[model samples]
Target: MSVDVYLGLSAIDSRRAVPRATKCHVHLAAKPFVVVGYHLPGDPGAPIGLLCGTRRERPSTIVVGEPREAKLRLARLANFAMDLNGYAAQFMQTPTTSRRALHTHRPANGPQLVVANQATAQWLCDVMGRRLRYLRPDGDRPVHPGLPVAGAHLSFFAGQRVPGSSLVLPLTEILAQHWVTGQLPSLDANLASQLAWITDPGAVAEAEDALPAGPVPDPEWETREFSDAIKAYHQLVDAHPTRADQPMTGTIHDALRPSWDACWQALDLLHSLPPADRARDRWTQDVYQWSRHAERVRSGQAYFRKRPKQLQVFRYLTRLERLTADLSREMALDDPLIMAGHVAAGEALSGEVVTLDLSGRRPSLQVRPHLPFPRPVGTDLFWHLPRSTSPSGPAWPIVRLTTIGVTPEGLITLDVTAGAVRRDRHDRLPQPGQQVVFSPFGPRDYHPDTLPAELPWTHAEDDDE
Candidate 1:
C-alpha cells in the first residue's frame, strides 16, 4: 500500500483525518471564484441554480424557476455565465508586448473554480457546457448570446481536468491530497463529510439534518421541498406574466444554501494551508493554456466539435500521459516527504554517499538503498537533484543505473552513467557523504513506443464538424 493510504488506515484509531501533506499541492488563486451549483436529478442536464462570486459575505445567485423551460434556463445562465466569463475577462485585458509573454506582464492565472468535487464540475461542464455551447443564437431554439460563450468557457474549464491544471479545482480531490480521512474513498468525495473529519473529531461527519453538498439534491428533499417549489413557481408564473419571480428563485436558492455555504467553508479551510513549492510551476502551465484558449476565442476559432476525430483523441491521450508524469516528477522533487514514499516503494532510495567518483569520465556514486529491494543488474534510474538553481527547480535528472558489482550480503554498487549529473553553474556534484535519492521518471528513463505520425485506417481522422 502507498504511504498515504497506510497513514490513512492508521488514522482510524485517532478518529480524525491524518494530514499527509504539509503544503497544499493545488494552486490557490489570489481570488478564486467559488461555485456551488445544483441541477435537476431527474433531468441531470438541466441546471436548477448556481451560486458564484469571489467574496465570502455576498454571492451572486441564479436560479431557473423552470428547469424544463429552455428559454428560462438559458436566460438564468446568461447572467451567471457573464459572471463566470467575467472572471476570465479581467486577465484578458492585460496586453502583451508580443501576442505571448504569457498574455500579459502579470501572471495570467485565470479564474480558479473552487468547487465541491468532480461531480459539480460535470454538472457545470458536461451538462451545462454541452447543452448551451452548440446552441446557435439564431437557431430554432435561440439562446442568449452569452449562453454559448459561457458554455464554451465552461467546457474549456472542464477540459483543463488534465493533471496539474488548476482552472477547475475540485476541493475534495485537493483536500484528499493534503489530508487523508478515515472514511472510504467514495465517502471522501463528499465535501461536508471530509471537512467534518478534518476540522474536529467530535464534529459529525454525516449528519441526518445536514444537506448533501451537491449538483443533485437528495431524493427526500426533492420530494419534500424541491418538487413543491417548482410546482408553485409554475403556478405563480402562469398567474402573472410580468409579476416578480424572485419568490420562486428564492425557494430553490434557500434549499441549496447549505451546499453553497459548505463550498465557501471548504475554500476557507484550503486558504489556511500553505501552498507547495511546485504549485507555482503547475499554475504557470494553467495560465499558458488559458492564454492559448483565450487567443483562440479572440481569433473566433473557439469551437470544439461535438465529436472529436481520432488524431485529436490520440494527441489528448498522449498529452495527458506526459503531463501526468510531469506532475509526479514535480511532486517528488518538490516534496521530500513525498519522495520518502518512493523510497518505501523501492522505486527510489536515500542515504549517505559511500563512494563518489566525479573524477571518472562519467560521475558515479555507490550507496545502498535505505530500504533495499532486490533488483536485476543494469536497471536505469534517475538522480533526484533537489533545490537546484535550474528553472525546473529540484529536477529528477541523470542517466543510467549500472550495477557494477554485488556481494553475497545483497549489497550493490551502482555505477552512474553519462548524462546523469545536470546542475546549475554553481551547483557541484555531491560529496562523499551527502544524502540523495533516485527514481525512474517515465519521460526520462523509459522511452515508451513513440506514436506514429500516420494513423491506422480504423483510427484515421476525418473532416467531421
Candidate 2:
C-alpha cells in the first residue's frame, strides 16, 4: 500500500472510498472470459451452477440438476468443458510464434480465465480440478470424456496462478492492489464492498442490489429462495422431465445475475485505467506457460499430483518467493505511484543530484534525497540508473553504495562507489539537478539447482542390504 492511498483512506472516513492508484495494476485481455458461480453450501465440493462468457449480456449458464448423481453432474461439467475448449480453439488459428528456447511450437495467445476473487479461483483450481482430473472413460466407473479434459485445463490454470502469471486473474485481488477502502482488508475481499468503495458512495457493503458474489451462497437466502426453487425444480423434473428447463433457468439466472453484473462493472472500472507497463511482459510469460501446458495435454502427458513431496514443496515455495519479490520490484519500477509506497517506507529514495566529484580518484557523485531517510548513518544504498544510461543495453544499470550520511539540515547524501565506468564522458554522468532514484532492487536471477535423484544415506542400510 502507498502513503497516498493511506492518506486517501484517512480522508474518506465519511464516505469509505479511496483511489490508491492512477493506473491499473494488472493486464486484462481484450476479451476476457468472466466466471461467476455458487456451490452447494454444505458440500462446497459439489457445484450448483456457473455463469461464464466474454460478455455479461450473453453469458451462458450451466446448472447441475441432480448434483448427487455422479453421471448427471459429469454431464453438466462436460457441457461446460466443451464451451471452454471451443472458446480456446479460436485462438489456435494463428498462434503467435516465438523462437525462444521454451516456446518453439506453442500458441502465444491462449484463453484467459477470470473470477471474482482468490477463493473462487481456488475453488476451480484445487477443489474442482481434484474432483475431475483423475476420472477415466475406460475405467470400471466410466465418466464423461470431457470431464478429464476440463480437469486437465483447470489443473494447469491452478498452477499458473503464481505471482507473475495473469492467466487466472482474480478481480478483487487485482482491484485491491490498485485501491484502498476504508473498510477492513478482510471485508474488502467481498466484491460488493470493494465495488461500493470504488464506484457508489451510497451503496453499503453487501447491499440488496449488490448481493454476495459467491461460490458459497448466503445461508438465509439459500434457505428461503434457493431451497424452495430447487425443491420445486426436483418435483417438476420428477413429474415431467421435459418441462423443468424453464423453471431451473429462471432460478439460476436469479441467483447469478447480481454477481454477473458486478463482474462486468468491476472489469469496466479496471479497463478505464491504463495498464501498468510491466504487466505485458508478465502476460507474455503466461502465454509461454499456457502454450507448454497445451502441448503437454496434446501429448497425453498432462497430470497434476494430489500433493507434492517434501523436497518438491521446498522448491516450489522458494521459486514462488523469488517470483513474488521480482514482481514487487517490477511493480515499483513500472509505476511511480506504487514506488511512492517504498519511498515512504524508506526502501527507496528519489531526489536531484547535488554535486559531482569527478576530480577525486574514485569519481563519485553526491545526491540529496528529497524524502527523509529512516536508515542509519553508514547504511549502503545503490542507485538504479535507467537502462538508457548504459549504452551497452544492460537491463538494469547498477551503482554500488560507497557511503551515506545525513547533513545538519536533515537531508541525506549518497556517495556512489562503482557505477561511473564512463567518467571521462561528461554525458554519462548524471548532471546536477537531474532527478535520480535508488533502491535495493537491481538486476538478479534465481535458478533452483536440480535435486539429486537419490538421497544420500547418513548411515549404511543396516542388515537389510
Candidate 3:
C-alpha cells in the first residue's frame, strides 16, 4: 500500500480525510459553469431541478413544477438549454485555423460542465440527452428549439467522459481524488457528506435535515415540503395559464441551496490546492475533443446509433486502457505523493546518487535506495525522465546489487552494457548527489491507429440527425 492509502486506512480512528495529493490533477477553469442537478425519486427522465451559473452569487434556478407531465418537463428545459448554448457559444466564437482534429478537428478550449457526481452526469447525458436530442423542433409534436440544441451539447459531453476529460467535471469524484475521506468510499459520491469531511475533518453523519447532493431529491423533504407546494403550483398553473409563480422559484432555490453551496465549497477547496504541472496541457486535449463534437454537430450528421460492433468495443477499450495508464504515469511523475505508491509496492525507488563512473566501456551509476527494498539483479529500471523530448529508443539492464555496511542497505549498481554516452550529453544525465526516481514503468508501445476495414452500421444511432 502507498503511504497515504495505508495511513488513510488507519484514519478511521481519527475521523479525518487524508490528503492524497499535493497537486490538483483535474483542470479547473477560472469560471467553470457549475450545475447542481436533481431528478424525481423514481423518475429518471423527469428532472426535478437544476441550479446553474458561472457566478456563485445566485445560480439561475430551473425547476419542473410537475415532473410527470412530459410537456412541462421539456418546456422547463428551454431556459436551461439556452444557458448551455450561450455558454458554449463563447468557445466556438474563436475560429480555428488548423486542419480539423482527427477525432474532432475543431479548436482547443471549450466550456466545462460541473456536476455533483457521476449519477448526475448520467442523468444529464443518458436520460435527459436522449429524451430531448431526438425531438424534432419542427415536427407535429414540436418542442422548444433550445431543447434539442442543449440535448445535443449534453450528448456531446457524454462522449467526452473518457479518463481525464475536463469537459464534464463531477465535483465529488474530483474532490475524492484530492482527499480520501474517513467515511465509507461509497459515501464519497455524496457531495455534501464529502465536503463536510473536507471542511470539518472530524464531522460525522448527523440527523440534520440536510438534502443529499444528488440526481435524486430527498424523499422526506418531498413528502413534507415539496409535494404539496408542487401539487398546489400545478393546480394554480392549470387555473391561471398566464400567471407566474414568483414564490415557487424561491422555494425551489431554497431547497437546493445546501447542495448548491456544497458544490462551490468543494470547488473552492480544490482551487486551494496547486494544480499539476501538466493540467493545462491535458485541458488542451479536452478542448480539442470538444471542438470535434462541435464540428460534427455543425455538419448536421447523425450521432447516436445502435451499432455497437465488436471491433468498435475493442478499439474503445484499448483507448481507455492507454489513456488510464498514461494518466496514472503522468500523475505520478508530476506529483511525488502519487509516485510513493509504487515505491511502497517495490515497483519503484528513489535515492540520491552515491557515485557515477564514465571511465568504463559503458556508463554506470551506484544508487543507494532510500527504502532499502531488495530488488533482483538485472532489473531494468527507467530513470525517471519527465523531460525526455527525444524519440523512444532502447534501454539496458542493471548488472549489480550490493549490501552497504552491515545493515543490508540496497545499494544498486546500474550498468549500461550497450554503447557509452558522449561526454557532452552529461547535462541530461543524473549527476552524483542528485536525487532521482527509477521505476519499471515505461512508455506504452506505439502502434498506428488503423482500423480494420469492412465496418458499417456501427458508428451512430438511427435516431441521430
Candidate 4:
C-alpha cells in the first residue's frame, strides 16, 4: 500500500466512511454489457435464471419453469446464448486491416462483458462452455448453430479475464482496486456492502439495503419468499399449461435488479476516472485476440477444450505472470496515487534534482527529497520526463543510482549517472528545481517476444494409444 492509501484508510477509520479517488484509473471502452443472475446451488450445471443486457431498463430475464429437464434448461440457456452471441457478434462481424501488421485483419473493437463478481464470470464460462460447446445442429437431438457459437464466444471471453484484458470485467474487483473500504476485503466482495461503504455508510447498518448479489441467495430469503414464489409459479403451470410463468421470472428479477442497478452505478464511478494510457492499448490487443478466435469459429475449428495440453498450460502460466507485472507497471505509471505505494514500499522514489554535473567524463546528478530513501548505492532507476512531446511518446528516461549520503543539514543526497544530452534536447533533461518521479519501469517493453511460427515436436504429445 502507498502512504496515500494508508493515510486514506486512517481517515476513513476516523470518519467511518470510505471516499472516492480523485479520478478513475481503469480503462473502459464503453458502457459495459452487464449480467446478473443466480444458478441452482445444488445443481452446478443447471442455471436457475439470468438477467442481462447492454442497458439496465431493457434487459432480458430468463428463468427455467422446469429446471429438472436437461434439454429444457439447455434450450432456455440457448436463448440467452444466442442473445449474448448476437451482442458480441457486432465486434466480430467486421474486419479491418491491422495498423501494426500490414497483411493481417483485425476487428474494429471488442465487446466488454461485466458480471457481479469474479466467481459469477468463471461459473458462467466454465459451466456453459461444457454444456454447449459440443452440441450438434444435425444430430438426433439437434441444437441451434448459435448455441455452440455462443459457447465458443463466451468461453473465449471468460479466458480473457486474465490480468491484461478489459473484455471480461468483474464489477466488485474493479471498484475495490480504486477504493479502499473501512471493512475487510471479504466484505467488499459483496456488491451491496461495497457500494454502501462507497455511497452511503448508513446503508451498511441496515439489513434491508444490503441485499445479496448472488449465484446463491440468502437461505432465509430462499426458504421463504423466493421458495413460495417458485411454488406458486409451478402451481400455475400445473393448473393451466397455456399460462405464462410470470411469477418465477418476477421473483428472480427482483432478486437480481439491485445488483443490476449497482453494476451500472459502479460503472459510472469507474467511468469518472480518466483511463490509464495503456488500457486502450491492451483493449486493442484484446480485439486482435477476439478476431483470431472468431476466425477459428468461422473455419469450423472452434472446439472448446476441457483441459489445455501440458505445453499450453506452461505457456499460459508464464504469460499470466508476465501480464500481471506489465499491468502493475502500467497502472503505477498512469496514476501518481498508485505510484505512491511503490514509493512507500521503496521500489521507487520521487524528488527534485539538487545538482547537475553535465561536464564530467560520465555525466551525473544528485537529487534531494523529503521522503525516506532505503536503496543502497548503484541501484538503477527511470525518470518520467514531464515534457513528453506526444500522448504516445516515451516519457521515462533511464538513469542509474550511484551514490547516497547525508549532508550537513541532515538531508539525504542521491547521486545519479546519466548520458550527455543533446543541446537541442535540453528541455527534456531534468533541471535543478523541477520535481521528478523515478521508478523501475522505463521505455522497455515487457511483452513476451513472439515465438517461431512452427510448433516444435516436443510440444505435440503422442495420442497413438
Best by lDDT: 2
What would the per-residue lDDT of candidate 4 be over residues 29-106, giving only the tens digit for each residue?
Answer: 565577887876777677778888887788888787666778878778877987888788777654534646521332
Error of 2 at 29 (Å): 1.0
lDDT tens per residue, model 1, 238-346: 7774543566567667876777787777777777877777677677667777777788777777787888767778878988887888888877766777777887887
Per-model C-alpha lDDT, please? 0.73, 0.74, 0.73, 0.71
Instruction: Report the lDDT tens digits of candidate 3 across residue range 114-231.
Output: 8889988888877788777888889689988888878888888877788877888898889877887776778888777777676775445641236777788788877877777676
Which ten contiguous residues of candidate 2 have the minimum total lDDT? 99-108
Best by TM-score: 2
Please list all clashing residue pairs in model 3, or write none if there are none.
100-105, 101-105, 104-292, 304-461, 305-460, 305-461
User: How many Å off is the CA of 6 in candidate 4?
Assistant: 2.0
Error of 2 at 149 (Å): 0.7
What tens digits encode model 2's per-residue C-alpha lDDT throughout 231-261?
Answer: 7778888788876555656777788887788
Candidate closer to the true structure by lDDT (higher is better), 1 or 4:
1
Ranking by lDDT: 2, 3, 1, 4
Report how far off residue 144 is in candidate 1 (Å): 2.0
Candidates' TM-scores?
Answer: 0.86, 0.88, 0.87, 0.88
Model 4: which residue pairs collide? 2-341, 24-273
- In model 1, what are the clashing residue pairs, if there are any? 398-420
Worst 10 residues of 1 by lDDT: 95-104
User: What's the candidate order when arranged by decreasing TM-score?
Assistant: 2, 4, 3, 1
